[model samples]
Target: MSKRGWIIYNGNLYTKKFAEQIKWLRKTAETFDFEIDVIANNQLLVAMEEGCARILTEKQKPDFVFFWDKDLFLARQLEEQGVRLFNPAKAIEICDDKALTYLQLANHGIRMPKTIIAPKVFVSLEDDSHLGQVIEILSFPMVIKETFGSFGEQVYLIKNEQQLRQKAKELQHKPHLFQEYIASSYGRDVRLNVVGDRVVAAMLRKSDQDFRANVTAGGKMYRYQPTEEEEKLAVRCSQIVGADFAGVDLLFGENDEPILCEINSNAHFKNIYDCTGVDITKDMMAFIKETITE
Candidate 1:
């Protein structure tokens, strides 16, 4: 019997981008003779009864799940049901929260930009005094990002104290982080797609319109070769995050050294494919097949 799997994406996203990723994953699975089904996260209901977990979907469970959504509960429930998930639940949790990702990587001595976690604030309480310390450490021209965001949508560049305070106040209720901005890496970064222990493809992204080098942010991409150090760092990050595969973004440090930016557990490969002509979906499927067999 051929191995079977399900590729789960966020149905609520309702964007062609998310659908595009699923299309590629399904294509790869077909090539490997693996029966793969594409499903939405919300399509399955997670139920708990008498200390037992069950998925309420009518579809039968597959041998594994290629989870491309950030619904932690659904991911964990699937894991509890003995359905192995690509990148796993814990990996998805850590990577979904920027603060947690940084903390875990820092524990392993990963080199990243200096980051400070924002303190939680209640909606009724208004205060910006605590952020003064952040200003002292990171100064102006810092990067502010929500703990949970993607596609470069909720990131901000604070150029002065006023902007810093305003951004802080706006996000006081949500978890966020502040980091030093690497001038050298402004609007430019490298994205390495790592499958298992190896980087299968890489693309350098440069933005002409904004500080974020994300392709969704109007950045351009080009096929590029990664330095040995860069490759090692990307793979190491994947291991640290407990990810079977990841999209690791590295900022340019002084003298072109690599500094960790962020890791995406369900990174979209369409742009990378267009830029590098390397389809990581195939490597991902192969890795999944080998891992499940092992």
Candidate 2:
């Protein structure tokens, strides 16, 4: 069996660093006589359609496909055609949906922050069946999050009762989640980078006066050691979510219990590298190569 793979990415492949990853993978793959292809979205759906169709017809197709969010429709179409996806479509879907992640984690006894889901078009506060539950379990200064939010951009802090109600009123047509703000995270959270079943590295992110510690939000990160519990949680989440390499976000609760925030299906490695000096891409690619060569 020849070792071969493909990487799906956006037009950002124009950057040298992006190409380096593909180049490195290809070189490493050649040791096993593997062929690798990198497809970018610059030419629209051409790469997706051609790639997906070829894999179905060609006997010598890419053994593994690593994806980084160019288009979901394209991704799904390829998977439906039986292309071997790195993180299966189902796993990506679970990680993308906050409500689903919570449900899965809770079912498996993984501790996570308190989360509440409201329909996109929530008409009124009193019209919620789960409103009572939120009121009972969540207190003021809670966090209102958009389920599909990324880079900590769509997170809002509802500092007072009025702000929560006001934002809720404005978002009558949009879906959202209400999570108990563990004021303890205090604009800081732990992100554990997991590669396959092992944790490559971990870091603690701190935001300024804000509750969200995402690096994009003027936040700083420091080195961190994943506690046994955190490491287990990271591995469990990676296995369950099917992420080859990802960052698992967690924070300490009032009781010092680890509460999961969310898991990144396609995490940003630059931040992790700047903080921890770990080159996660090399390890991520190594796993697939080793598996294919084996």
Candidate maximizing TM-score: 1
TM-score for each of the candidates: 0.97, 0.83
lDDT of each residue in 76-182, candidate 1, tens digit only: 98888888999799999999999999999987878899999998877832767778899899998999999999988899999999999888878878989999999
Cα deviation at 50, candidate 1, in Å, is 4.3
- What's the true lDDT of residue 223 in model 2? 98
True lDDT of residue 157, candidate 2: 86
Model 2 residue 169 lDDT score: 72
How displaced is residue 194 in candidate 2, in Å? 0.8
Query: Candidate 2 residues 197-234, lDDT tens each?
Result: 99998999998867788888878899998789889988
CA lDDT of 21 in candidate 1?
73
RMSD of each: 1.3, 4.0
Task: Name the 10 consecutive residues with the lowest summed lDDT in model 2.
Answer: 50-59
lDDT of 2: 0.74
